[model samples]
Every structure is written in C-alpha cells, then in structure tokens.
Target: MEATELNIRISFGRKHALALLSAFFLCWHPGFIGSETLQLTTFYPAPYGGYVSLLTTGGTNTVPANTILARNAGRVGVGTGTPDSKVDIRIPVGLGANGVQITDDNANPDTRSYATLGVTRAASGNNLAYIGLTKQGTYPWAIGVAGSNDLIMGASSAGNRTIPSPMFSIDTGGQIAMGGGAEAGRRLRVVGDLRVTGDIYVNGRIQGLCQRIGYSITGVTSCPWNHNVIGFLGDGVARVSGFLPASATTSGVGRFIVLGEDWGGTMICCRF
Candidate 1:
C-alpha cells in the first residue's frame, strides 16, 4: 500500500485572479456549451445581428425547405429568399393556406366600432393605387385607374392579366355608369330600369300625364266641364244622333244613333 500527499503554495496575482474569474463565468453562462443545455430566461440589451437566412424546423436536426430572409436593404421575406416589398409572404400553390387574416378580439361591439384592417395614403403624399380581390383560378376584380387614368371598378372573364370592359364604373368627375361607359357631365347612366316612387323634376318642372276625361257615347250628351269634344267613338259613324232611312218596314225616316259601335266606347275630350 502507498499513500501520496502533495503540498503546494499558491500565490495571488492580477492575471491569476482574472483567469479564475473567466473560468468561473464559462462554466455557468448561457453561451457555455460543455454538456448541459443552455437556457436563457431573458436577454439584456436584446439581440441584434445579421444573417443570410433564418429558419426553424419541425424536428430536431432537420433543415426547413422554406426560410425567412431579412435583406440589408430592409426587406423581409417569408418562404422566399428575395422580397419585393417591405414585408412579403409567399405561400406555395395548391397549399391550403390563403392570405393574411386580421381578427378583432373585442367581444362586445357597439355602433362606434373600429375596423380590423385599414389602408391609408403613404407618407409621400401619394394616394393608394388600387385594391383587388383575387382568387386562385379567376382573374382579379379590382378598383383602380382605367386606361385614361379614370377611377373605375372592373373585372375580367378571360385571363388573369386581362382587363375586360367594366361592368360598373365611376369617372373622375364622380359620374357613374352601369354599363362601363361614363359620359362627361352626366350624373348617372343606367342601362336598366330607373324606378322612382316620388315625382320626377326636369328643369324645375314636375312632369306627369295630362288630365283628361272620357264618357260613354250611348246618347247625345254635352261635354262635361266645358271641355272640347275631340272625336266620336263609333266606327265610320261620325255623329251619335242621326236619322236612318227606313227600308223594310215601310215607315218614315227612323231616328237612330250608332250604339255598340266601337264596342260602346267612350267619347274622347281634352282641355285646350
């Protein structure tokens, strides 16, 4: 049996103290990766850096097919390496995902409610160009400028990029059209019926049917209200009261009037 015992004298210096302190920090710090996992509850001063691509996978040690990229020119892309806008998201075709959705979490809403999403003019004093509703298999229906720079809402039937004639449109001067042809100085032009329950006014005058009266011409009667008699109702018989020559009964001139002529129609008269 052998027993060994060693005795050493330790001296303290600035370099030794620094080395020991550094080793102490390397053992328990979050950046240390010896054998245990690194868990960070909070970060101080936050993390700021640059990376070509950042990705997260569903499983460990698996690389994701799609990645999020942040470019140096301040563009961020999701599922794409290069983005054209400030923030762009690209979903693969035939995927179940569509576009973005915004939900309002307010459980109780009243008359004075706020919108979930809003589009406004840019800070450069330029108005918004257009807004569109697009589907996967159909052309987009959009509200935008026409070829002449007039504001219009239009749709297409042929292809994705094709712009068909507008089904409905509004011009720059606020004239509206139902058939896509908005003429100048016209307030509204509709191809279909224009129904109005109230009176129609043209040049400060209310337009309506003229007042006239009719009467059955079974006998000779004076015109009511002193209105002028226009014509008789009988066919080929001008006057109502007349004498017909007797032919069969060997009688004198028989007093007769055209009755049941024109199907017992009415006398026409109008106020002049």
Candidate 2:
C-alpha cells in the first residue's frame, strides 16, 4: 500500500463553505477499485447545523456525476449540484424521468407537518402552482400558486380540525352546491340568503314564494308587508284586506308566487 496523507477536510469558517475535493485524492484508498471508479464523501458546517454530501464522480479530474446531499434546510437532494430548497432534485435532459410521487400505505402513514410542491415561475419568481398535504405546527403550508388564484376542492386542510367556511361544494354525482354548508342530499345549498343580479330561467315549474316589503299594503292587516323576501315553495293563507278583494282568503299552495305593491298603489299577486 503506497502511503499518502489526504486531508479528509471540513470547513469551520464563518458561513461560507466550499468543498475543494480532488478526484485522485478520493480513489487513493487501498480498498478502492480501479481508476475508472470514483466515490467521495464531503461534510460542511453551516450556521444552521451542517451538510453532508455523498458523490460519485468517475476517474481523475472528473466532475461529480451524481450526488446525494443533505443540507441545513432538512432537505435531501439527488443529482443536484446546488440545492436551494427542501427535497431539491435536478437531473439533466435525456436521463431518467424527473418527477415526485408520495403515497401512504400501512407502513407509511400520513403524519407530517406540511408537504407542499410549489411550482414556481420562471426567472426565480413566485409560485405559480401548488399542491399540499398539510398537518400543523412550525411547518404550515404556504400556497402562493397563481398568485392567490388557487382553486381548492374537497375536505378541510386540517383533516376536519379547522373547517373553512363553505364557499362552494360539488359531489361525485355531478351535482354542484353553491354557498355554505351543503344540505344532506341537496344539489345546491346556500348558507345565507341568495340574491340574483340577473334573471332566473327555470326549465320546469319554479316553485317558490316571492314577496316584496318596505311598502304600505292598503288591504292586508299589516300595510306594506316588509318581511317576505324570496324563496322556493311555502304554505300560507294570504288574506286580502284593503282594495277590491278585501278580506279575501288567498290559499297559498306552496308554489311560486310573486306578490308586491304596484307603482299605481295596487296590491298585485301573481301565482304560478
């Protein structure tokens, strides 16, 4: 065995760590194979703990072909020369595939802080797309995808722990639910009152009770009934109190009815 002293070195400098490892210095070990194979391990100390890199760079004076580095950011990078984030991986074109997949099985349960895939924009811009599996604690999911235009579907982020006020909901049956907490078996449910800015076109029979208030009703007991707004289907006995048909008991059969005061001071009731 030829004797040599190779500095299996480390950096204890301020925060600037740059490893200067030569190829021949690595294969100088006695148990190493031929000159065609090269392997080396380098460790660096940083302000936030340290970093370890295991690299395989072929023969003398050769650059590293593959690297597995674990850095201060709790990140592991494979095939990456310089990592900037967590789980940073880079592979050149014409190599293998470049993608990430995470699945949970019996042995691997989904029990972690926050796991997010941020698809950032070009020129080191902000995130354009994101998908995340969030838990809790110091690592909360930060989604800057589409610059605040991210569309999220389904269950709560904290596994029903912290519930978000329902914006909209859709089930597998192709039924769309708008507004807040969905009804048990309803296709559409709005937590609060629904207001329509445009016209409503109904395919079939539109069953609902519509009434306008804030005006004085000449015939009814309460002049200018100002309570009933707009809804779908209700049962009530409407008594006409004032005009031509005063004290007329109008039977409301839980159907669409538009009742309001006319501009000419007339009580109009249109039932359909």
Candidate 3:
C-alpha cells in the first residue's frame, strides 16, 4: 500500500539537451575556464567589400581567413619591382641593427643599363667609356689602345716628374728610321743604367771593345799605339783615340782606326 511513492519522469531534446550539457561541462571543468580575453574579427567577402581589416585582442590565435593582424602600430608599402620580383621582409632575431642598409636619394640620380659588369657607379656625373680601369685620380688625357700591335710590358707610373725618353721609335716608309738590322730587329733592349746626354746619332755602327797588351786582335782592324790625347784636368775630359795594331810601321806613333776589329798589328808607344 506504500508503493505509490515511487514516481520518475525525465526528458530532454533541443539538440539532445545541448549535447548533454556539453558532456557535463566537459567532465566537470577540466581546465581553462572561458575568456582569457580573446576576440578576432577579419572578413573579406563580396567584391572584397572591406579591402582589408584585422583586429586581435588578448589572442590565443584567431583571424586567419586572409590574415591581416595589426595590434599596436603599422605602415607598410613597397613596390618598385625587379630584384627578382621583390617582397622579402625578415627581421627578428635580435631585431636588426646593421646588416644591410642602403638609403639613397641624393637629389635622385641612378641610371644603369647593363655593362656595369663587376663594380660600378656613376650616378650621373658624366661617365662615357669604352674602357676605364682606374686606380687613383686625375686622368686628364688618357688614351690607351692596343687592338693588335702595342706592347708596353711592365712598370708604368706617371707624375712626380721623370722623363728619360727613347726606348723605341721607328717609322720607315715615311723615313724616321732607327737601325739594328733585318728592317729593325733590335728596336730597343736596355738592360739597365744608361745615361746619355744629347748628341748621339748613329746611323749604323758605334760598337765598342778594347783590351790590348800583347798584340791583341779579335776582329776589325786599325790600331798601332802612339796614343796621346791625355787631356784630363777635371771638368770632363776623356776623348783619347790612338793605340794598338794600326799598321805598325811606326813613323810618329799615334794610330787607332779600329772599325769592328779584325786586328792587323802595331804597338810602339813612342814614334809620333
């Protein structure tokens, strides 16, 4: 008779009681209890209605549909193409302070078309060239051309004043010749220290060699010892010509006709 105290009834639907009350508050509040403050809004739909916009607050990640996140401050615009389709920005690792920096606009001047092969800069101040290999300054009149025949080999530095001309020069058909043979075999071959001051015109031969003590004759005649042009008291005096194998008939000594040596004999110091 007391069995009528038993009465039970329960029913829930609206999406199964909101998924069974979200699985009983995710198994009794497992952790992270709502709103550590996060709000993000970004939208780009019809005709890009809102060109671009992004807002984030106390983020844990959001706004990634065409991302544009600006939280504190910003301004960015770079478009001057070509450098391999430019658009590379990366700086974050002790955030930059000198690694690459180039800011130029000295009244705007920069023009380069190609042939700037290795290292070049002539940002408009007149630089026309076919060839220009520079080291220092001042090239008032510089012209160096060697397409086929023009050989300058070795040390060359100008200015500080040192001009010791004549290393080479020969012009034949128009007559301005120099001689050595075979048209011009020895144009110039100077070994070292050679100082000649004025007046030296040798159209053919001015050879030298002499060491006679025992009727020495190596080739190219005339020398018979009478030698006496002893004039030397300083200021410059050495013009002696008379001695050794020049037809030794000795009549008043003094003979030297050595013209490329072939030795014919004479050595008598006192007869002329």
Candidate 4:
C-alpha cells in the first residue's frame, strides 16, 4: 500500500500527535495487523541525491547489502564505492579470481569474439597495443604492435620504462628482421654471415661434398700465371729432371720435367 503524507500542523499534545500519526498510517495500510510489517521508509525520497562515500548497508528497512555505488562525480563502482576510473571494479576478497570475462553465447561458428581497443593516433616508437608480463624483481617483458605496424617483443631496460626497444620485429609484409634496428626485405634475411654446424641441404639434397679448387693439367711442366703445381705424376720410365722445390722461384713456375723416356702425365695446379 502507498503511504501519503498529511501536512498537519497540530497545536495539540505529543500524545495526541502520536495517536493521529498512527491513525494516518492505518488509513494508508487498511489491512494492517499487529504481527505484520509495513516499512514506511519507501514512501519517502532519499535524503541526498548521491552518496559521498562507500555504502555498506541500507539501514534496517532497506537492503542488507549493496554491491554497486555511484560517486558524486558520476563514477560507478562495483565491489567498491571509492572508484578511480569511469567504471571501476575490484575483487573484494578472493584467492584466485580471474577478474572479468567478455563472453558471447551465440551458436554461430563464424562469430567473432572481440575485445577491441581503438586509438586514433599514436606517437613514434610507441605501441598501439601491448601485453606485458612482470615478475617480482625482474625486468618486464612485452610483445606489442608498434606504431609502424611491426610486431615487436622486447624487455624493459628499467623498471619504470614505458616504451620498449625492439629486439626483433616482423614487418607488415611478413618479413622478419633480426638484430637491433635491422630491416629485412627477403624471405629469410640475417644480419650476419650464416654459419652451419651441420651439412647444408638444397632442394632436399646434400651439398658441398667436393669443390673444384684447382684445374687438371695433362703433360704440362709449368703452370699458368698465378698457378702452382700441387701434384705431378709421370709414366713408368720417366722421372723429374730437377729437384721439385716446395716453393716456386718465379710466378707460373713448375719443377717437373721428363728425364728418361718419352713421358707425360697430368699436373694438378692450384691458385690461391
């Protein structure tokens, strides 16, 4: 039942006023009983327009508990009343709370679940978005999308650092750059010369079995310019006419010669 206020200026005794107020209450609630309860506070407006501090209870006739609160500056809070942001929420008491989750229960397979952050413009060397991980006493690490559209992962040099230097990055074209400040234009580009610990394979076949470092010479005593005789062989009856020196005296010099019978053999010449 709705209670109506009666503007009565009674020039009577306090007992008379109490009797008249009880009669007025009985008038609004016609079916009132001795054991029944009628909370009369609901029929009146709140004292203040908003709350100045956190509200723990709503008195005897109101709610027993409250989980939502609005600040005087129009900030709403959940699980707390002293909000800092526009909509602040904090876990009051929990051991392992996951905080919040944005979910969609639609039965469509191709439905996109989105949690988007949109920024109109970003400063140079800044991240458009980033996820950071930190330990108790270690430098924080982060992986982020740079302002230039490169995906970068870096560790903070200091504890209070905001922007992170890129250790390596993948550009918008799917090319990855290694080392600091390096750019890649090929499919796999490295900043330094490659060193292989194992055998290299090309087109699924092993490479670098043997390399042709020198040319074969048949029946030649002296090699060409910048070439030296590394190995020489003769026929059964032929021997070297002179002593074969390990070092050549002159450029394009050879110590091999035919001594006894007509003899000719190949000479392996190598150039450094």
TM-score of model 1 vs. true structure:
0.32
Per-residue lDDT of model 4, residues 215-267, tens digit only: 22333456677766676654445444655555676544556554753345556
What CA RMSD would you report for each candidate?
A: 14.2, 17.9, 22.2, 18.9
- Checking candidate 1 for backbone clashes, the offending pairs are none
How many pairs collide in each candidate, listed in order?
0, 8, 19, 0
Which 10-residue span in candidate 1 carries the lowest summed lDDT?
118-127
Q: Which lDDT values do the candidates have, in the order given? A: 0.50, 0.40, 0.30, 0.50
Better of 1 and 2 by TM-score: 1
Q: Note the residue pairs that clash in candidate 4.
A: none
- Could you arrange the candidates by TM-score from highest to lowest? 1, 4, 2, 3
Error of 2 at 99 (Å): 4.3
Model 1 Cα shift for residue 240 (angstroms): 5.6
The lDDT of model 3 is 0.30
lDDT tens string, model 3, 117-212? 111111111111112222323221211112212321111112211112222223232222221111335445444455789887878864433333
Q: How far is candidate 3 from the true structure (C-alpha RMSD, Å)?
A: 22.2
Q: How displaced is residue 233 in candidate 2, in Å?
A: 25
lDDT over C-alpha atoms for residue 40 of model 4: 24
lDDT of 2: 0.40
Residue runs of model 1 more than 4 Å from their true location after superposition? 1-131, 157-160, 194-243, 246-255, 259-272
**Which residue ranges in model 4 land beyond 4 Å of their true spot?**
1-126, 157-163, 181-184, 192-198, 203-272
